[model samples]
Target: MEFSQLIYRKQRRWNLFAIAAIVSLLLFSSLYLMVGEVFISPFSEVTPLMEQLVLQLRLPRLLTAIAIGASLAVSGAVLQVLLGNVLAEPGVLGISGGASVMMVLVLFFIPVFATPVGFMLAAVVGALLFTLLLVSFAQVARLTTTRLLLVGVALGILSGAVVTWAFYFSDDLSLRQLMYWLMGSVGGASWYHHILTLMLLPVLIWLCFKGQVLDKLMMGETHAKQLGIDVEAVRWKLILAVSVLVGGAVALGGVIGFVGLVVPHLLRLSLGSENRYLLPMSALSGAALLVFADIIARTSLDSAELPLGVVTTSIGAPIFIWMLVKNHDSR
Candidate 1:
């Protein structure tokens, strides 16, 4: 096929994928609205209780799930492209670990600072610190993407140890709170949380979109320099943007896993490796995945709801394992 024809075919595929994602999101939203205890069977018979549940409770949760999922997924896509590593995710880079550490500190010291804003601020600080540290390590070591992944793994392990120590020394109530946060859930989602997520997501998404220059940079530092792109500046900016995005999501919903890893990898496989389309498509696909997961979390059991992280892991781990096997085979 001609190069122009291939480009058109790729664009057509992405357009169709985007359309399917929209339709899926709509269906999931409708399902979320419709599947509660106070059931309204028909559209005409929808009552105040159902409306309240849908509008006040379900809608906020749905929006939060979408925001968190999309943020993490977009961040993942950006990191993957920037680092030129398919395995790179926000959580893998210790962003989530950093957030968890700050959250644990707040719970340990100033209990009153456990509010959403305080939590978000702490998470951002932690993530930014880690990002800087990681970048510095990369520079000093002249690290490859594989080396970056190892560094991230080490950081994550160290942070996990810190969190474990904090939990070990805490009281029952504090430990309980920390456990819930670590496991992740959308239980406390409110209009305020929704608003905060909405406000941050757009700015972060725009930054990721702006990082198209990094895509060119990935060809090599020499090539990027030739093209007049400041490779180091772009890398730092992408890191900061991802830190904020992932940190905010962690603050709101705790340490939900796999959405970042799962969504972007799936998109890369389906839509090919263009960050422009991969970023948005991953966001949409991630939102759809989390919304569906949340629906299962709420309605799967008898009285109490399951943790959203539990549901995601239950689904994501097998998929991840399968991908690992496939990757190994390909290699």
Candidate 2:
């Protein structure tokens, strides 16, 4: 009876988290659409220009935020479990940096990547390549969590150097575009971007279903395999999914940081580490957080919009510092 009650209590908490996330997502998404450079009331009549603004501009941007937030947050959660560390953001783990490097390389050299599919492929290739490098390095060095983070940082620096080298030879227009992407923005989201987002939503759903397998993995790889989890296959599957998702996110939203690092870790601490609740909640909370941040980024300054990364970094950097301090003190 006590065990059943405990299970019921856990379920209740999970439901509450899901409800809160949904409510927040709906509220913020509405605010994101309605409150912009000019306010548009959802119920009231508006001009064609306003209608177009909401449909063509704000909606796509909003959806892009959702896609990026959900994917990055989930990816971060998965990586934290896979790497057994808190500092597993896409940017930190070289995933986003890798994508950025490949993206710039393609933009500078490959005219075919001017298309959306080519752009996505380049980012995926970069992310996968970096994943391989990270795995190899970790295995070769027998990396502890700290060492893994350091290696990831080194990889990121290397990728940045490559991108910087490309920058010198690139034209001014490409340079400006690349800089905007590096900084991150949803200002330019279009129907093409929406197509990518739609394709990705199902994949995110599939990832959420991976929660059970991920939960098993947290118990240790050997234990998971003993329990018939196909540990290695699951590992590769998740890494590939994360690569595609992170690659898609970087391609779509540019290297927006900390959503993955911050969101999942916080959720784990607050709500408990059960992936079933954690994964879906992370997605919703991530979407809400990004929408909130994006709102602040564009609207905070009069007649000027800020980059998404600047806003997130300003907020996340402090949280990150606090996390490190707390973890260090605990140790």
Candidate 3:
């Protein structure tokens, strides 16, 4: 009876938290649309200017932010479980770095592939290749989690070196564009990318439902196998899923930092380590966070917008430090 009551109480708490998360996402979404340079009241009469701003400009950006945010957050959550490390994320794992490097190379060498779609495809391919490479290293080297993370860091450094070389050779126009992409911004969002954004919905849905698999894996590979889970098969599937999520996010948003790292950590601190609650909440919370961050990026300056990555990094760095400190103290 006591155990039953405890479970019931936890469920109630989670339900309330879920409700709050939904409300927060809705609130931020509204603010994203309404609180830009010229503040428009939600209840105000709609003008043609307002219509264009809402539909053509703000709506797509909002969707992009939401999609990318959720993708990164969920990816981070899964990665933490897969790698058995709390600090694992797309950026930290070199997935985003690989994508960015490939995109930059294409932009510098092949001017014909300069379109958004081309950039996205290039990023996905880069991410997929890098993911496969990481898997190969793990399999061949029989590395531990810590060693694997170090390998990822080394790969990220290699990617950075390649990007820097491109930067050195790029023309002024290309240099400026590359800098903006590295800094990250969603200002260039367009309706043409909506199909790609919409396609992520099914992927996100599939990932969310894998909470049980993630939960099992958290018990370690040997234990998970004893529990009748095919650890190797599941790992590959998850890696592929994460690669897509991270690649799509980098492709759309240009390496926006810390969403993956920060969102999952915050949600875990609040909701505990249960993947079932953590995954969906991370999705909603991540979407809200990115939308909120984009709002700051849009309105923080009077004339010029701040880069989206700058805003997120500024917010996430302190939280990340605090998490490190807290973990150390707890230990």
Candidate 4:
């Protein structure tokens, strides 16, 4: 296709997908805020206590979910483009793993930093540390793409092993409480948590605007550099972006897995792999899916709630298999 024609096609896809995602997100988010323990209609008659519930509880939770979903999806899309692998995600770079390890430390070893703010701080720091380490490795080792990806996967596994050891050996918290952090949840949502998550929006926005550059990188590093893109600098920026977003997400929602992995792939199948459309659309769809999954997590059980990560992974696993099979058959 001609360059102009490709641009036109991408724009059309963006408009259509954006419209669909907005409608779906608004509908599901409204439903989410309404369908709690007390089934209150969003636009119907209300009481003061109900209003308080909506404001203090449901509203913050919904916002936090949106932030987490959007951040993960965009970061995942960026990583896929950067690493040239569909399986590339937040975990592939160990961002969430680093965050999880820090959270474990705060929960047990550092009692002074057990608050929400403290956890968020520690998580971001750990995430940045691992991300920078990866960048340094990429630079120093002059590793090929496949080798770099392997290194990232290895780091993530190492981080997970450390977290597992901490969870099992420590007696600071109950097994159930610590396990939920690993599985992921938004039940701890509050305005403070919401604010901490919102700080990542600027990074996400900057990344969404980087679709043109990312699209070039998708071609190949040599081709992208020939096209006047600073391939190395963009890689560093995107690495940092993914790290911060994933770190914040882990802090806010725990290690919610599938948003980063599945959202971008689903949109790629439906719309096309043009990053311009994929990035923003992924944000919208991610928000919608997370909010919807959260509703299932909240209402699935009669008495207690299910972990959000389990819910997403359960839903994503089958869909991921189907996607893989379809790709295989198409090839």
lDDT of each: 0.80, 0.86, 0.84, 0.83
Q: Report the lDDT tens digits of candidate 1 across residue range 1-331.
A: 6999999999999999999999999998788877766554545566787778878988888889888888888877777766667777767677788888987798679989877888887888888888778767766777876578789978888988898887877678857766776778888889987656865766666865764575676688889889998888877777778888878888888888778888989887877877777777888888899999988998888778889989987887787777757866877
For model 4, name the residue pairs that clash.
none
Per-residue lDDT of model 4, residues 213-279, tens digit only = 9899989989999999998888878887887788789989888876787999878877788897789
TM-score of structure candidate 4: 0.88
Any residue pairs clashing in model 3, and if so which? none
Highest TM-score, which number?
Answer: 2
Which scores greater on lDDT, model 1 or model 2? 2
How high is each candidate's TM-score?
0.91, 0.96, 0.92, 0.88
lDDT of 3 by residue, 1-331 (tens): 9999988887787789899989999999988899887788988999999999999999999999999899999988988887677877787678888999988888878979977778777888888888888777766888776688789889888987888777877678857776786767888888887766876778888999999889999988888999999998999888888877887888888877778889888777776777888899899989999999999999989999999989998998788678767756766
lDDT of 2 at 262: 93
Sorting all predicted structures by TM-score, with the top scorer first, yields 2, 3, 1, 4
What TM-score, to 2 decimals, does candidate 3 have? Answer: 0.92
Cα displacement (angstroms), candidate 2, residue 245, comes to 0.4
